[model samples]
Target: MKTTAPRDQSRFAPDTASNGSVSPKNLLIAVDDSNATTRALQYVGRLLRETPNVSITLFHVLNPMPRELMEHGGSENPDMEHQLGEQLRKDQQEWMHMEETLEYPILERALERLRDTGFPTDRVTLKLGYAGDVVDTILDEVRSGGYGTLVVTRHGPPGAARLFSSSIADRLSRDLSGIALWVIE
Candidate 1:
C-alpha cells in the first residue's frame, strides 16, 4: 500500500518540525489489566510527564459477549418470546453497565499512575472501545486518531500461550509503518 512520509516522532520525546508543529506528539497507549501494561504506562509517564506540550491517549478495548450468546432463544409460553426480547434488552444494558463498572477502575488506576508522574489530566485522554481483536482495535484507533506514536507492552512468556495467537507487539511491528511504535518491556 502507498504511504505518506513518516512522522517518526518518538512517543517519549516528541519531535518538532520546522514550522513548530509537533509531529506525533499525540501518543496512543494501549492499556490492559496487566503489570506489563502498567509498566509501559509508568515508563511513558517518567519520560513525558514533564513535557507540557504532549498529549496522551489511554486506549482500551473491552471484549463483549458473542453474538450467539446475545441472541434470544426460543421460549415455551406464547408471550415468552416478547418477554425474552425484553429480557435481552435488559441483559444487554446490564452487560454494558457492568463493563463500564469494571473498565472505569482500570482506566482510573492508569490515570492515577500518570497523574502521580505529574502528567496533567487536561492533556490526557481516556478512550474505551468494544471489539473482538485488541491489536486491530488499537491500530484502528491509531490510524483514525492520526497518532504519531503508538505505545504497547510486550507481554511476557512469548511462547506456548501465544503459539496460536500472535502477540500485540509482534502484529503491530509487522503491520505498522510510517509511525513510531514503542514496545515497552
Candidate 2:
C-alpha cells in the first residue's frame, strides 16, 4: 500500500467569478454604525485574510426623514408653517452632512481592520445609498453592483432589535433568492 501526503483542498477550491479569467471575489457587506456591523466586518476580514484576488465593498444605506414631516408647509398658520419648513430644511441639510462626515470614519476603520488581516487596501471600496426603504435600496445596490456575496449582521442599530427581531435578515434572505446572503449572529 502506498501512503501519500494529503493535498490541501482549500488551495484547490474554486471560487466564483463572472468570467473564466480570475476576477476578484467581490463581496458586499451591509454596514451601519452598530457594534454588530463592526463585528461582522471583523469576522469576514479574518476569514478571507489569505483569499487571493478578493475584494470587499462596504455598503451603507441611509434613510432620510419622511416627506410627511415637511408636509406641514401647507398648514393653516402661514408663519408657523414657514418656521416648520425652515426647520425641516435645516434637518435635511444636517442629515446630509452626517452622511458625508460620519460614514467616512466608519468605513476607514473597517478598511483598517481588513488591512490588519492582510487584505490589500486597494481592493476595498465603499458605497453609500439612500432611500426610504432600506431593504429595497440594498437589493438595488446588489443587483447593480454584481456582488458575489452579501453579508449583514442579525441585528441593526441598538434600538432596532426590539422592532425587527431578525425581520430584516429574514426578508433579505427570502427576497435575494439567487444571491449569497450571510447573516452573522
Score residue 168 of candidate 2 by CA lDDT: 80
Q: Which candidate achieves the best TM-score against the true structure?
A: 1
- Please write out the lDDT profile of model 1 over residues 70-164, one tens digit for every residue: 78887888799888888888887777667766776666777887777777777777767566677777777776676779888777344424311
Model 1 RMSD in Å is: 9.2
lDDT of 2 by residue, 40-64 (tens): 8779988886788777777666555
TM-score of each: 0.72, 0.68
TM-score of 1: 0.72
User: How big is the positional error of residue 176 in model 1, measured in Å on the Cα after superposition?
Assistant: 2.1
RMSD, every candidate, angstroms: 9.2, 12.2
